[model samples]
Target chain A: MRKMEFAEAIESALKHAMTNDPDIFLMGEDVHTLRINLLAQFGKERVISTSISESAFLGAGVTAAMAGLRPIIEIMLIDFIGVAIDALLNHASKILTFSGGKWNVPLVVRTSCGGGYGDGGQHEQSLWGWLAHIPGLHVVVPSNPSDAGQLLLSAIESDHPVIYLEHKLLADYWLDYMGTGGRENVSFDVPEKGAIGEVPEKWESLPIGKANILREGDDITLISLGVSVHRCLEAANILSEDEISVEVLDLRWVSPLDKEAIITSVSKTKRVIVVDEDYMRFGLSGEIAAILAEENISPIQFGRVCTEHTIPFNRHLEDNVLPNVNRILALARKFKS
Target chain B: MTLMREKTILELYEAMYTSRYLEKIVTQLWEKGNIYGEMHLGIGEEAIIAGVLSHLIPGDAISTDHRSTPPFVMRGVDIESLLLEFLGHPKGLCSGLGGHMHLFCKELLLTSSGIVGSSGPSAVGFALATKYQKTKNIAVAFFGEGSMNQGMLLESLNLASSLNLPVLFICKDNNWAITTRSNEVTGGVLLDRVRGFGIEAREVDGSDCMAVWQAVETAIPRLRKRNPAPYFIQASCTHNEGHFLGDPLLRFHRSPKKELGAVTGPLTKSVLHYKGGRLDKRISSVSNVLALIAKARAQLSFSNDPIRRLEKTQTHLKDQFAQIKLKVEKKINSISERVLNLVQEEASL
Candidate 1:
């Protein structure tokens, strides 16, 4: 077992993914070790950087997808994704259906999200929800280092446009989520593909469209994703003794939603709750209820945990809205028996 | 030079004529209360689009302003979708959210945006990708003369020049940024401004669609240079119609200098010739298409459930929107009480 921080795990997984697939390349801000190391390990042709042109490169990534190359487009900050919405929404998200599925965008957009280090307004927003609403797009929010590595590899390998959300807070966080570096990666002079066995007895394919039940309970089904999922897990543990066994579902992939898991869980639990790190109105929770109703699941109790439009900072305040054990516990207590 | 084959020239003229017809129809639609929002028309400026897009090869990327329909139509945008878009139907190109300003054809990479100069840096981004990937695909950014002053446009020039990226910057110099003339926005010509940034720049008569096309086509070769900056083409033309149908024509008629009208007048002659149907059934053919679009638009407006049909087209889109919206907003749900406290307790961004 090797110790790996989120960034290093990402490095390890990226190195392996590139070695396995000759088409994966990196494009975004910053190019020292992350790109150079990949180029030296893979080849100059496989790793690269851009000149702060998010929209163009994202569009280029879409273009490359048409040529059968998988591209990893990076946004220096999650807030910067706004600059390339045209590429993401207009081009990448609709290329498949727009071309009637003749062109599949094998694209990966990696971005760092959340508030930290007093960066102020524009730099500190967690706008993953903005990306989630786009159709023909897949989204992943890796909670820790190991998951970051594995998910990044999977995203780069996948045939759809995937927005891999990495929390700014996890840049230093560590975990062991990798598998054996496949034979193709042996030439890349790198560490193993950082999969240190899936979390205890859990399976790790973590399909891009499935929602996993992190905690099983009889009272309420608490839905969440990314960093909030972990917070909900903590809340479930805290509220365990209120005779409220809150069922926690980690909606790992936001698009191509796993409605089956959500609907089935809500049917059994009856008390439905959602913790979204995006806006409330016209966001995921509302859409999930709308979907549940269409699926003939009537009387699904609805609740959401989301952020307001105000720029987030001051850890204490952000902690309140970004979903911590306290809020989830409170919601669990209020909604569950 | 406006030299071209007879058929090609006629096609170009026809496209421009169609744009003129479209502009008139849009104005009539707005006046008739069929259109929902404000729309910019390229009534007198059809040549800029018809000219530049005529020479665009496959895989050439281009960006446009709200007043950029003629070029897209010339470049093969589905007529059905184009009219539906103007009518604000779900069948419209952008599912109707884009309205008039947001028309985009992903396949052709023709984008229309309301945000001025925003596509500048984005054009640079595409050029960077193609250069890195070794693709021959070239991107074009079409903006108004006023956009020449936008910071991003300047930044894009530097970025493309520095990176030696392949991009064509086409300025549809309609001589007026609304009421103000081009001279007022920049000290010298827009082409000079682009060249000052070390980009290859040229000026063309925008009304001559064939000339505009030739200029851009010629510029593409220079963009292939190792140290190529973005090639800038200035299409000097006129906006025969007002900014939007809601805008008063009399205000513009009396606002600009009288000399401007004689030089940049509306295509009244073209429409006048059309009234005499026998002069050119070719003009009559365009009207026939317009009549069809008008009928489709009327049905689209009367239909209460077109959006429902659009939603059905993307059946999973709503749910998918919700799921991602949930992920994006999860923190907000947790933070509402905190935000309320902050407003009450701190009131800071």
Candidate 2:
């Protein structure tokens, strides 16, 4: 095992997958800029940098996957996915069913979401719920460096389209450039406790539809994913000092949600609070709530902490809109009462 | 045109005839309500499809738009399964999940979508895969002139040129986007639009099979080179059925008096009303309407059927033409019968 950063883990996974599978290639706008070493190693034929044509490139990636090549496409920002949503929603997501299960698109679309450095509304969004709603898509959000590497490998190996969202704050590049803003009061250090972990040196793949119990307790349960998982852990630690034993569940895959794990955790705790960075309406938190309600596992108290239905901008306003440890703690305290 | 061997010409004619006959049968099926949904037949664009696809070798891939039957037929995709698919049978090509608009054959490397301009990106992707595999295979994209205005298609054109991918973009221009005339909405010359991307662009009479065949024959060698580049062809054809079967335009032309009677009284009242426009302006508007009707009538009378044109050019092979026609009809009839019987059995079950 070796200590690895989140971004380094992603790059290492791509390198290992491409080395093993000759049919795998990478293409997108400015992908060459991020992995110049990949361009050098794989040559220009495999590491293709395309024009600023998201619809064409993404559509091409979908078709290339159908034509017996695995393509890893990058859509610089998750918010820009609207420009090429038809390629994913209509084509990649429906190709298998449309072709009567004859053609399976084995492609990975990796994009960054979340905002802390004031990238504005257009650049900041965690729309995993929007993607998970699609029928044939697999949405995977990894919280730490270890799962980041392993889940990505699993995504590449799957015979369906996978939307892998990486939060900006947990990225290695964002961590390195945190202080570049020169705002002395704004402490932009990596806030997550387990963002960096001992990733296996040899290539490994984590299953796609499983949740991990990050922390164990019985008094109350905090369920979340992506960066919110880290915030929940932080909130759990703070609540522990108040004689509150908090259980934190990190839901790695959002689409094929680990409902069994969620039920097991919520059943054990009997009091649950869901912390989600996505919007409150029609999002992951509501889905979890619906699952619990359907199962008739009525907890003593249930609550939710999610982003408001608004685009995040202005550092203070973005912080207020996004779910932070303070809000998770407050919600946990309310559930505890 | 003379450089093409007689055997090759006969082969092209056979493919064209087969596609035309198959679409005719499909039209009858649709009329009988055996096939459901909108049927967009490649009736008039047969020359463009057969002309180009006849030269395709193994490993070649094709991406096509909604009017994809001719290309798939010419490429030798199983006719029985294709008919079964059109009939919505469980044993169909896509197991009745996808109608005629969406068909795919994994072994043939052929895909078609109802999306207007998706063929561009799909073909570029296939070409990109071929380049990575270091193969001499090429990819062809078949779209209509209406798709030229689509941003994705334009982006695909620029991308193919910039990346030097081996793709052939075939624009089957029937001068119509559904009911609207394409030239009214399109800007500038299409050949110029393609040439602006630094790719070689050509125009061919889609009614003449030999002309399209020769143009593609000259372009294929350049595409097979190590540093392959993209090519574009704008083939001017006609939609013999107007756009889709039972098109109102064709219905109006077929019985003008009956069709226009309902609108004529209201139209005259609007023209005579003083509140709307001046006398001469309204009169000129009526004259423009008359001129459009005349043009439509003229188009209907003209024969741009590629199969008939090819038959006209093959007068010396009258006996061979008769033989080919008989064989094609027999084959189509047998496949249609088998498909209908299977669908009937499935329905009864």
Report the number of the highest-TM-score candidate.
2
CAPRI level of candidate 1: incorrect
Cα lDDT of model 1 by residue, A1-337, tens digit = 5566566567667765665666777765433223333433443345454444567777888898779888888776677676578888888888889888787888888887764222233445666666778777888877655576767766876888998877654553211011011111111111222222232122123456766777788778888876677677767777776667888887777776788999888889888888876666777888888887888876767777777555332323434545556666666677755
Model 2 lDDT tens row, A35-60: 44455445556767655457878999
Cα misplacement distance, residue B333 of candidate 1 (Å): 42
DockQ for every prediction shown: 0.01, 0.01
Candidate 2 regions exceeding 4 Å error are A1-337, B261-294
Query: lDDT values of the candidates?
Result: 0.62, 0.80
After TM-score superposition, the amount by which residue B215's alpha carbon in candidate 1 deviates from its true location, in angstroms, is 36
Which regions of candidate 1 are displaced past 4 Å?
A1-3, A33-36, A173-206, B1-151, B155-349
Q: Write the per-residue lDDT of candidate 2 for residues B1-349, one digit (tens) a residue.
A: 3499899889988998899899999988866756543567898898999889987899999999988899888888889888877775666686654557777888999998766688999999999999999999999999998788777899899999999999999999887765445675567988999999999999999999999999999889879899999999999998877666655556568777865774466456545643433466556545544554555554464488787888888888778888999999999999999888877786699
